[model samples]
Target: MPHSVTDTTTPASHPTASDTSGRTDALHSVPTGLYIDGVWRESSDASTIAVENPATGRTLLDIASATPTDGAAALDAAVAAADDWARTSPRHRGEILRRAFDLLTERAEHFATLITLEMGKPLAQARGEVAYGAEFFRWYSEESVRIDGRWSTSPDGKSRLMTMRQPVGPTLMITPWNFPLAMGTRKIGPAIAAGCTMVIKPASQTPLTMLALADLMTEVGVPAGVLNVIPTRTSGAVMTPLITDPRLRKLTFTGSTPVGKDLIRQSAEQVLRVSMELGGNAPFLVFEDADIEAAVDGAMLAKMRNMGEACTAANRFLVHQSVADDFAALLAQKMTAERLGAGIDDGVTVGPLIDDKQRRKVAELVTDAVDRGADLTVGGERIDGPGYFYTPTVLTNVQPGSAVLREEIFGPVAPIATFTDDDDAIARANDTEYGLAAYAFTASTARTIKVAESLDFGMIGINQGIISNAAAPFGGMKHSGFGREGGPEGIAEYVETKYIGINPLDATVRNSHTDAR
Candidate 1:
């Protein structure tokens, strides 16, 4: 994935009304140091990795990369801090989380700037991401003490059995670069609420926001080592040893399907508990009864979000034959009208790909699809420039066998196809190997419920484009990866169940006055 660094070229210079504002910040300064044991400290040496602004190919910051020794030390600190954090009162823990959430909201603009600089997302989108990230802490904070055990009556009526949920011990949280703040908070917030200390390894591509969040956690009085954010140049320094370590009881990740599987296999050495939110090729289904205008607008917002890097972003556009032509024409028009520019620039509707390699891969996929007979409707070429700029694209007449239809084109290329009838559409939607998220646009109550139930995806939105929220259980079925990452289910992922049994000496023995009454 390594390549020669090219001089950054700004897609555009000024901001426009269409551009998301307040998210961009000048990033000529370096943000160094790994946050370990509640302190911001450097790695053994001043070894640092340069982080680039995907929007313009500019070096945003130089972050300290932890070596193997530093990774080991972070783990040690987390282990040492686990017991005290677990013993802390649930109410107190919840208060700290709430405080962190408040701090994040108050400073949302700052974090959004970091996101725009490091991840190349629009200012508005970055602000929304910060809001979403804060929600995770808010939700889990209240659910922390709600964990409970159950008592069951014994068959013999002489004994009682009790079951309770307990923390899973020190955890290793690895987040992808796509939604840096959101993913890290999704994992660590719930883990902390469940009384588990953690060591977080954020994607080197975007580590500033995560480090900032760690600073906030410490400011809220979160104990040292209760949450450690270690930004490293070499992922193996943290991942390899931690996966095999016995003390690192749980491993949580949000990344590609291949990486998720690899983590699961490697964690088998200690039989570590794992929760993975892997790759998804979500299907955007449109029915005859659906509002065409609303659906089209929603589709653009959903498909283009994060430059289409999200696992839950709609990849396949399944339009009913009744409205296929109109839908495609409208979608193509919307895409064409969009002004492609840097994340910080005004009037910019779409940003560049994360890096040159990603841009090349997207270009290859589009070319392959075109070569295979798919119609390139709106976009199919990389913009002539220095940065990794890809035009917002739309394709039609895409055969089912085409790579565009079969694989996840993790860019702004939206290849649309048509289908007739409910069963056919549902079948086509569920045909893929990945099933993390899906969307259906319809007004028919019966069809809405039926299609939502029938779709093989974990998260489905009916007539609504926004599917992910802190209150909902976010995950997928089949190859999308196992386990949930939001809502009450998310916090439960960090807990272990224990049972206690009690036996009475005799049936009805020693009946006290209070017991008889």
Candidate 2:
């Protein structure tokens, strides 16, 4: 079922032969095969999936497309290595993770280039991702040795209570294309730190970055079969059996809500522990008491980071009525100035969507918003070009009923609506079923605390825009999915706790009996 990119409809212009050649050379630096049991090899059928450059609509290279059998093999490898990996000393595991962090930092440019080429984010942004992603390894390296439980005396005074943490066993990690490196590292770092072996399925659209990271991990001495990478186009076919298998203990995914729900359903058969970071419809709220320029900067970062192809990207902008007009104008002016082109190009801030399908979806959302009476303030149409590029867009006076306000618009579009007061802003923001992330800009400390406490989101940015960090617990509630993915809590997701109770009298008797023996 995996088809080549050539089979898809081509864009107005293909990458020049020279361009393709240079990209091909870059691709050659990393493994393109399925990594299993410490070695990279072809899939069962040796079929390949074409990875396309969104900026050029040209084939970058073909990676090994895994089949159901290949998936099973990966699961088997993980199962085989689970016990030994779990038994490995926490300090030793931490050391490996630390080394991985070091190697990733040293090769930051290499991985960043692959991210930009495959995922189409600007090069600078890709570099930023590399830095962000590497932090996970660093943070978890320290967390590994700190995964501790507790010992306590029972309230009855007759027994002692003890607890210990252990790896959850073989895990399956599914990462999204929007953050090829960070998402993977966020999941992998914790899994490694907790001594859990895993098989990762990177998004087919941008598997190269993960593949390169896998290579780096191997070089840094991640045990064979401890980590596996399988990039497959037929994800359901490949993952269903693994999910049903008794050997698999945990499943973690970062993607859309629908797919996450389906995976959760599949996991239910085995009662597997699941951690999902699903879709988000984040809101950016601007209050009248806020500093306008600072609020604008926060809006830009909240709305435009990763070209707005992010689950946490602000989907709705609810500005107070007094500052609504000013916020919209300033945001539009800044958006209009962003240069759109290939991510590799110098000074380009925006890049193409992952594929034509994504571009079409963004266009449809914008059209629906406009048709529903939203004012198209700036950049409304698709660009005339070879790539799947849409103009950075800003829509003011967006109707509450518009699709843009309700749905997660994973594009470079910002829809601004007016709110009368704090209560109104909070109501409008929490109207959706999502609770992933939210942002508010205000100068008042009291307002910031009040709004932060009131927002129905897992993460809140009070007066600041960028909220994600390796040291923070990143996740969501409601339909946005559950389970933390960073910080000390992240490692907890990959661990199981065991409680032990010892009766003092029984222990004393056992000791006497042992002495007699």
Candidate 3:
């Protein structure tokens, strides 16, 4: 069910010290209201959605909730700005993005605090997100001027052919909540760099980060209508009309596979170009020759990053039979040692889940795994508190058919399964509908090459836990969705290619006549 919106104007009180860990002032400073056509204002119907602090389950603030009319207006704004923005000099656009990157870095602390408040990532992790997210702007700023095309003679000797890339025109961007700031910058940076105007509908659960980001863009002189942000409780209600509208030339979404499919279906009506970054059930493989300590470190980073709410989080830990016990023991110890609490709290390593619903889902998956013969190594229950807190759990001897092995567990839970050899590991890793990301830890150069090549996932981490980088393309295969984000390929998703051919026969004839004269 969607959260209810209200028209009340009174401000919500700040959470207590225990709730925010002394970051209440930063929370109070976050921007509210919808940003459209360079102006920030209330929704057309004056309704507002309450922004809740996932750590405390307290109302942090209320953001203006956009309606269908507001969505249409945002589209109108994007369409209106499309022509001029596309015509704007690439260098000028690059400069604006560069400034935004600098400004974001300067204001990283502020944005990081807002992200922790709304998205429930630990402050340190949120800071890491800010740094990673800000890099997209810098990277795309460099890419803006590098949008090159091709020119050459045609196969027919008399003709010359040229190809150029143009903005797909006004675009609709829908970002997910898990990594609020990074997700927005990943899409928005490329769109802006490609000279495409955008109407962004950020996830309501973490809209504040993007809302605050809008202010940063505005401060850096992003033109009116080039970017419009609309936050609403009912995403489909607000986005459906825009998705169907002919003016919306492209649609980019980062969310679940089902939602991405629905959006893709709607986009087909207009033959709209689309990009989807959907779900994942990443497998973390540990071979017999792997260093147990290094493998455990990688597992902690892969499985516990963002409290394991990430699509790329390692859902199934596949270890060799020889070292499975050691790997699971070390992983269990690290998982237990993680200090779980409010994101804003100092020294807190793991934060609460996004909300009660997410907590419930994590709990159910753990219960199901335990019921299916998996050994509960450590931390398997929800913490009794006001916040949506769940223990960082580890389950070893996980049954092959356990739901944890098949599903994307979007929480701090790691399930270990044993594999006999390289072939077995590869088979088990690829036995899912999702092929977003996969990891393998092995000291042998030959094994690393074999496993990395054999795995069906789009992105692979040979020995490293972290795979995302601004300079590398990030995307998935199979049901994880199509299209790439980051690197040079990122901006290309927002542009269309056109070919022009010209006959040189007339010019040749004119040259001959001139020579005869």
lDDT of each: 0.83, 0.88, 0.88
Tens digit per residue, CA lDDT, model 2, 1-517 = 0011111223222332233224334565778899999999998999988888887777777789999999999999999999999999989999999999999999888888789888989889999999999999999999999999898877655689999999999999999999999999999999999999999999999998999999899999998999999999999899998999999999999999999999999999999999999999999999998888898889889888888999989999999999999888998899988888778766778888888898889999999999999999998778665677888899988987899999998999999999998898999999999999999988889998889889889999898889999999999989999999998789889999999997777543234555795
Clashing pairs in 3: none
By TM-score rank, best first, the candidates go 3, 2, 1
Report the lDDT tens digits of candidate 1 across residue range 168-245. Answer: 999999999989899988897888789999999999999988888887788898999998888887886567997898
Query: Please, what is the TM-score per model?
Result: 0.93, 0.94, 0.95
RMSD to the true structure for each prediction, in A, is: 4.7, 5.4, 4.8
Number of the candidate with higher lDDT, 1 or 2:
2
The parts of candidate 1 lying over 4 Å away from their true place are 1-31, 509-517
Which residue pairs collide, candidate 1? 14-346, 15-346, 16-346, 16-347
Candidate 1 has an lDDT of 0.83
